[model samples]
Each structure stands twice: as C-alpha cells, then as structure tokens.
Target: MTKENMEEGVNQKNVESTQMKEEKKIDEEDTKEAEKVNLTKVTTFEELLEVVGTRGKWNVLTFLMCILVAFTSPLQTLSYQFLGATPDHWCQVTPLLEANWTHQQILDLAIPFSNSTGRPENCYMRDYDYTAAAALGYQTTMKDPSAVLRNSSSLIQCSVREFNLSQYISTVVTEWDLVCERRVLYSTTQAVMQGGKLFGFVLFAYLVDALGRRPVVLVCSAISIIAGFLAAASPNIEFYIVLKFIIAAVDAGQYLGIFVFVMETCASKYRAGAGTLIVIPWAVGYMVVPGIAYVIRPWKLLQVAYTVPALYTIIYFWLLPESPRWLIDQGRYQEAFKVISWVAKVNRKPLPADQVVLAAMENIYHQKAQGKEADSATKTFTSRLLNLLKQLLSLLLISELRVRTIIVFFCWFSASMVYYGIALNATNLSTDPYLYIFLGGLLEVPSYLLLWPALIYIGRKKSLVALYLFCGLCIFSVMGLMLTYPGEAEVAKVFFSQIGKMAVTAAFQLAWMYTAELFPTKFRSLAVGQASFCARIGSTSSPYINDLLGPYTVWAPSALFGSVSLVSAALAVLLPETRHCDLPESNDFFTKTKEAGAEGREQGVVDQDEGVLNPSFVSEAGETGSQIHPRKSDTH
Candidate 1:
C-alpha cells in the first residue's frame, strides 16, 4: 500500500458516498411529489354533488332562502320608485302661485297652510309667476278691463273706491298659493323622505349584522307593508311623507339583510356570482319604478303597487331557512349539521355521517383555537364594537382591500348620480317621463347577466376597470353632447345619457362582487358595510350636488365622479389579482410582499428580513454555502 494508492482509494469512497446520497434525495423528492398529488385528488365535484344530494331537501330550501334574500334589493328599490312620483308632480305646480311674496311672508303663510291642509311647508310656491304677471308682462297695479269683466263688472266698479276688492283678491291669491299648492307640500315631504333613507342606511347595516338576517328582513317586510298602506291612505302631504320615510328606512333593512344572507349561504366557489346576482334585483326594481308610477297615476295608488311586493316578502319568511353559514359562524354546530344534512338529503345521496361530524368538530376546534366562543357574552357590545373597528381599519389599510373599496365607492357614487339624475330629469325629456325611466332601467338586465361571466373569465381587475372606464366615458360623452348641441339634439342627448346610466348601473353591480372577493370571510360583512357606508355618503351628496350644479350642468358631478372612478381604476392596478387567489388570512402587506418573491429563486432579496436571500446576484467574493441554500439563508 503506497501513498498514491491510499489517496486514490479515499477519493473513490468519497465519490460513491456522494452518488448514493444524491439517489436517496431524488427518491425522497419523488415520494413527496406523489403525496402532494394524492392530497390534491381527494376532493372532487362528484363527491360534493353526492354529499349535496344526500341533503337534497335542505339544499333546495337553502337555495330558495338565498333567492328570497336576494329579492329584497328589487323589492325595496321598486317600492321607493312607486312612491317616488308624489314629489315629482307636486314640484311642477308650486312656482306658478307664489309670484310676489317675500321669504318671511311665504314662510308665515306656509306654516298655517301646512297645518290646516296637512301638506309640507316647503312645498309653497317660490316668488315667481310664469303665466300671468311675469310671462304676459302685466304689472300688479294695472287692472285690465277683461280682468274686471271676469271678476264682475258691478263689484269691479264698486271696488275701485269703496270695497277695496283688489286687496281682498290679493289675500285670496296668496292664500291659494300657500294652501292649495301641491309643489309646496311635496318639497317638504321629499326632504323628510330623503332623511329617512339616510337614517336607514346607517342603522340597517348594524341591525342586520347583529340580529341575524332572517328576523330582521321579516321585520323589514312587515314594516314596509304597513308603511305602504299608510302612505296609500294618507289624505295629505305630511302623512304621505312621514309614511314614505318609514317605508324607505325599512326598505334599507331589506337591502342590507338580504345581500348578507344570500352571500353567506353560497359556496366559496360561487360566492362572487351569488353576490353579483343580488344587484340584479336593484336594476329590476329601478325598471319597475317608472312603469308602476305610470300605471298607478296618483301617488296614493302607487303606494298600493309598492305594498304588493311587501306582501310577497312577508310570505317568503315562511319559505326560507336561516343561513347555515351564519349559524356555523355563530357556533351553532347542531344547526349547521342539520342544515347540511338536509342539503345532502335533497341531492338524493347519503352523506358520510362520520365525515360530517369530523368537519363540524374541526370547525368548532378552529373557532375555539381562535378564542371565539358560542356564548353571546363573547360577542359582547364592547367586543363586537372593537372587532368592527378593527375590521374597518384593516379594510382601509390593506392595499387590495382599499383599492376595491375606493372603486366600489366611486362606482356607486357615479351610478347613483346618473340613475337619480335621469329619474329626476325624466320630466324634462318627454311627456311620458316614467316610460323613459323604465326603459333606462330595463337596459341594466342584460348588463347584469353579462357581468358575472366577464368577472369569472376576464378576472376582477380588468372587468371592474373596464366597466368603470366605459361608464365614465359614456357620462363624459353625454356631457359633451349636452353642452355642444343643447336643444338641437335634445332627444339624442337624452338617449345617450340613458345609455350612460345603464353602463354605470352594470358597473355598480360588478363592483359589489369585486369588493366581496377582495376581503376574507371573517370580515366579509364588515368590509361590505364600510364600503356601502362610503357609497351612501356619495348617494347622500348627489341631490345637493345636482341642486348646486343643476341637472343640465351635468359636468360637475359627472366630471367629479368620472375623475374619482379614473383615479380608482389607476389605483386598481396596484392591487394583486384576486380572481384565482385564495382570500388572505391577514392583511399583512409584508407577508404578501414576501410571497411575491417566492416564485423565482433568481430574484434579489425583497426586504431586510431573516431567512431571505438574494441567490442570483451576490458579492464578488468567494461564494458562501449559505447563499446557495435560499431556504436556509438569512439576509438580515
């Protein structure tokens, strides 16, 4: 054994050891890859269907429940539409009568008139006479022979000196303006009605999340029914407005509860589609409003049209079950199991009882692990409030969540401006105002149908941005046409504006789905409520902006909203695409940043964090072993 032979022998042993080690590592990797494939194969659509079939009866009931809940949006919006015309007709008749009165005199006259006649005080005519004194260029002091003849020649001749008949006639005219004018009463009533909508939005979100969807919605339906009847029976503007406001508030509850309920019931795979489906009712409600207003004619009659839907909603209470997902979240495992079992039975296949129990146990364990308890005390006033605040802050901070929220808010704001603007300006367009409004609303149906498919296929960011941009472009184009052509192309302008309204309505529907998909399950309702709250602010501001800018001064709100949407679209580019990604557990931006770099090993260090390394580009010194092992390397 020479020194050279011994060295060669040692080298051979080391080579064999290295080769064997490599083979073992390859075998281990293959085993892990096989296990991953097996795990992926465990769940299938057929098995899911089988489980669903075993509880077929319950599934049908749950499906119907979701549909019923989804129906509330249309019901509430349509009801508002039906009752909407009272103010419109009244606004038309006011200014003709109050021609020469001071504001103080009008106010003084309106208070007594409102009390005695049961109308709103604000509905009194403004100080403008369009027909006689102003339009014909006649002064109050000029007494024409024809006016004298119309009043009575004998009285006219006697009143010139003795009777002071002109003074009496002036008092009569002023009284008539205050007491008998529909516009004066309608204005006051509309204010109250609008205030009710504001209160409704704020309160309904809290109530629905607290009380559970079924009970709250049933209560809402009942309130709406009673309010509808009260509105129909009212003999005066005060009662009508008061009742209308109550109706609007309850309708808000219906809107909030139904959407939450339906979305909760749907499977994760179809949740976005189901959420989007809820908005279709709003479009339908909008379309139905004008037609019902036309058919009903008088405001009182329209109240009856609104009440009919309330009756249907009341009946729906009996047909629909409570949302099982909500029940599960509340830690009512027995109820969840019963509902799931029923779903399986309805699908006409047996559920694996042990698996069902195991799933329930796992859910309970997770809930406990998260420090959540079934007791109501655990969801106390302070705790729930804190949780809500935390959720709101999280939504605001998370880039993806913030982007979706902003887009939804702007879209909602724009849609509300255009939708309500069109409805308000219907009288300016044609004699058959309701028909035009109805037609505009009817166009949203196809748009709604097209929305979900586009979202699923094209992805959320593109669909939302595209819809928003299209809507903004439509509005801007309509504004351009209105400004440049004016009366010459009045009909064309109206048609174009209506098209913009429809496009915005579609965008609004899609945005709701997009917002829902951006947030996790735990904060789903809270995120929705906050976004909706921002939207309500937009809606609340629309009327004031319209009044300030004038409906024809379309550029103010149109440009403002369009700019908002454009900015949101740009910000949407910053959001990570969520169409295929699982909803994140926490909104930790750094976690997402780190995960972003996980795909490519050649990428540089994303941050100064431990366990992170830049493998591709290193210092020109001798390479370290740690740098080659990215998983084990520490950059910090």
Candidate 2:
C-alpha cells in the first residue's frame, strides 16, 4: 500500500476505536445510575414497611407516657374547683354571728381558751371575727341586724344554717374558716403548679435537647411519685401547696419529655397523629377528675386521688426505651443501634446488622458535612449568653418555627379559655358536672381519630381551619344561647355550652398535631416548649378573666378565643401545606427556599429582593417517608 493511504487508514481506525470506548463508558454510567435508583427504591419500601410494622410498640409506649403526662391537665382543673369551694366554709359562718352573739363573745368561744396546760392565762385571743366573716369579703364589727343582713354577710348565715351549728363551737371556726384555709391552700397549690409548668418547660426543653428525652422523663416520673405522695399526705395547707408545686414541676418535665420522646421515635407520617393521640389521655384525665372529686369529697383526699397516677412511673423503668432518633442526633450510633434492634426484636423482625451500621455511618457523615456548612455560613457567638440569644433569634425568626409558635399560642390560649370556661361553668350549666365533663372529654376522641385521616388526606391547613371555625361557631352559638334566653331555657343553655366544650376540646387536640408538624427536627423541643409556654399564659389568664366576668362572662373569653382562632385560620393560609411532605434535610431546605423566592420575584408581584423566602427560616420536614418535589422557582 502507499504511505498516505496507510496513514489515512490508521487515523480512521483510531477514530472508530475512540468512539467505541466512549460508548462503553456511557453504558457503564447508565448501569450504575440504574442500580442506584433501584437501591433507593428498595430502601424506601423497606423503611415504609418497617415504620408501619413498628406502630404497635410505638402505640403502647405512647399511650403509657401519655397517661403519665395527662395528670397535670386535670390537676389544674381540680385545683380551680378546690379554690372555688373555699367560700363554702365562710358561707357557713354567717348565721352564727347573726344569732344574737356579739363578735367578742363569738371570738372568745371560737378561740381555744385553754393551752395544753388547760390554763386560761396561757391562751392567746384570736384577732379576726370568726363568726362574722363572709365567704370572701372584708369583715365588719357592726352588729346592726340590717348590716348583718346584707346579702354578702348572709353567706355566713347560709353556711351556719346548712351546717346547723351553734354560736359556741360553731361551724364558723371549724368549717367556715377551715374552708377559707383550704382555699388558701389550693390557691397556693395552683401557684406552685404554675411555677412548675414554667420551670418544667424551660428545664425539660433544654434537657431533652442536651441529655435526651428518656432520661428526663424517667427522672420526672421519679420526682412525680415522691411529690405526689407528699402532696397526698400533706398535714396542712402550707405543706400541700409546697409539695403540689414540686409535683407539678416534675409533672411538667414528664409532660414535655413524653411529647419529645414520642414524636422523635415515630415515623414522620405517623408523627402528627401520635402527637395528637397523646392528648387523649389528658382528656381522659379531665373526665376522671370530676368522678375522683366526687369520691374524695375533701380537697386533701382529692389531692391524693390525683397523686396516685405517679405510681405508674415504676412501670416506665422497665418498659421505656430511649428514642432512636434522639440517639442518632447525639451521634450515639451504638446506642441508636441497640434501641432500633430492640424495636425490631419486639416487632419480630430482624434488621441486618450491617444495614444498621451503614445507616448510622451515613447519618453521621451527612450530619457532620451539614454542620460544617452551617458553621461556615453562620456567625460565631462571642459568649454563652450571646450564643443563646442567637439560638433564640434563629428559632423565632424561622418562618416555620415562628408560625408554629404563634399558631400554637393562639390555639392554646383559645383552648384554655374555652376548656376552662366550660368546665368552671359546668355547675351553672347543669347539676351533673361529672357527666358534663365526661361528655366533653369523650368528644375529643373523635377529634384525634379525625386528625389521622385529615392530616393524611386533606392536609394540615384545611384540618386546622375546619377545627378553628367549628370551635368559633360553637362559641358564638353558646353566646347566643346565654344572651337570647338568659333565665328561660336553663336546660338548653347548659346543653349548648356542653356542645361548645366538645367542639373546643376537639380543636385543642388537633392543635397539638398542627404544632408538631410546623417545627424542624433540630428545634422541635424548643418549638413545642414555646408553644406550650404561650398556652400556659392563656391557661393562667383564663381564671382571672372568668372571675372578673362571672359564669355568664364565658362569652368574653369565647369571643377572644374565637378572634384568635380566626387569626390562626388566616395564618394557616400563609403556610405551605405539609401533608405528605417529607421532612426536608437541613441542606435541601435552604436550597428550596432560594429557588422558591427567585420564582416569586420573577412573577413581578412585588419586590423580589424584599420578599425572598429563606429556606433556613422555614422548618423542613426531614427524611420523612414521603416524596418531596424539588423547588420549581423562588415564587413558591
């Protein structure tokens, strides 16, 4: 062959060879991609099945913890009831003072005249007029029959007549004043509960994030047991309030700890439902309170009745397991493995040991990488206080975080107002407080049941809005009944109020679920705490509002709560629908936020720069067993 022809022929061969090599490389890449997709599909299916199968164990533990945590709700209601009963004793003393006995004479007779030595000289005279004191008012020394006959003073006479007691050794000193003392005790008890709730939220939220949920819950249970016993056996009102406060504090810890534990352990799809279900036990506890109050009769015994739940904490020591999700968060792989293994074993399934190891490694690596990125992006704290403030600001500024906090606050405030308002006014509504309370609580069951389906199908916003609107309508209806036929239809008015109670109870249950869905995993505990804190503010304020307005004043709080519910409903419109949305990983969240904002700005609806949505500001659902679409543009 000629030299030129040989050169051309060789070049042609080389070109063909290169083309063949490129095709082979492309085929290999395609094969690898296919394998990766298949692997992901298999893993996703396995996760779904595993999560579904584990539901039984999750249900058991959740139910148990809920029962433990629920004691506080009823305790709060009972404390209110006990406080109301204080006037009973003072009411009993009125008639004794009206029975021709001088205030000095009544005081001389009522005060113990002899000391332990049985000597009159050793006795100290009591300063207050025991016989003349009204149920809950200032005392007057005047014995003018008409002055004594004033309706307020008549409370004492009414109590004396009811007890059928005499001037000397009268019910005024023993029963009437004792009731007043009991009132003071119960009031103190409530104050302790309030303090406990405040401290519990702050302490347990920090502890749940720092030490993990299981330990806090266990410790809280122990404290609850001890404090409960102390409260039950308290010899005097002073001791009762002190011990009750301690119990309440511990109980508060138990409350938040259980919530954190349950939500962390459950699959994301089941998280909202599980969170709402926890409130079932709380409703049950409320229903149980009136029955227990009837059985116990006295405030001290009622305290004991409430305290008995603390004994259940012993079961937790043996049965409860540390949350696998929390362990993973803390970078404790071995511990997470053990817990997951136990879960698998309990469910009669075997998890491949290596799969567990691989999953743990992947999670840790991903977390570390994300942490490095976040560290590079965010500012360093100059001091611990600044760091805390930074963290707080981060928590508050995040749209998902702030929205949930605000919504929960409104829900809680509204729920507390309506729940307590209905409960406190139960007597005004009907003679059967037990029946009324029981029905009110029983109605909440459907609410929880409805949440699972509503959340699964309709989404968070629709369900929450429906509940809020329903509650508002119920409140308005109750107000109408109270106003339109004030004294004519007592039966109908009471029944309508009960109906309102049921509606609000259901709304409250749904609110718990909605709040859980609105926070990211990292700040879940804090978000829940802040929401709870707002709720407590509502709970704390409800009593004062109720007292200031009276039973008929239910309309005031109902209207206030209704307005809040409407605002929440409007805010719900602003949030992205979270139903079936997989929890976003930390990285995916910010990327999507930027994409959404960019798209929004391109539409020219507003200044794109001003309205940019920060993905970091939105709480992302993380690794939930749901398909999430990539952000289309900045506009979303």
lDDT of 1 by residue, 276-309 (tens): 6666655677677666665555545555665676
TM-score against native, each model: 0.66, 0.71
The list of candidate 1 runs beyond 4 A from truth reads: 1-50, 53-198, 234-239, 354-361, 364-394, 397-408, 428-431, 551-561, 581-636
- For model 2, what is the C-alpha lDDT against the true structure? 0.55
Q: After superposition, how far is residue 185 of candidate 1 from its true place, in Å?
A: 7.6
lDDT of each: 0.52, 0.55
Looking at model 2, how many pairs of residues clash?
23
What lDDT does candidate 2 reach at residue 123?
19
Model 2 C-alpha lDDT per residue in residues 1-636, reported as the tens digit of each score: 999999999999999999999999976775454334322222221242343254766456555655556745565444445423422112323444556555444443333333332432111323344444443233344343333343432122122312213322221123334332233333334445655676677667777777887888889888877776665565655665677667666777777777767765666556666666677777777767767765655555666667676576677787777766666656676787777656655664434434644464355435434633334333544666676676655666765356546656666666655666666665444345566666666666775677666666666666667766676676666667666765456677666666656666666666655555555566767766766666656555554555444444535655665566566566655555555433332433434554454565342121211222322221256432212232323121
Highest lDDT, which number? 2
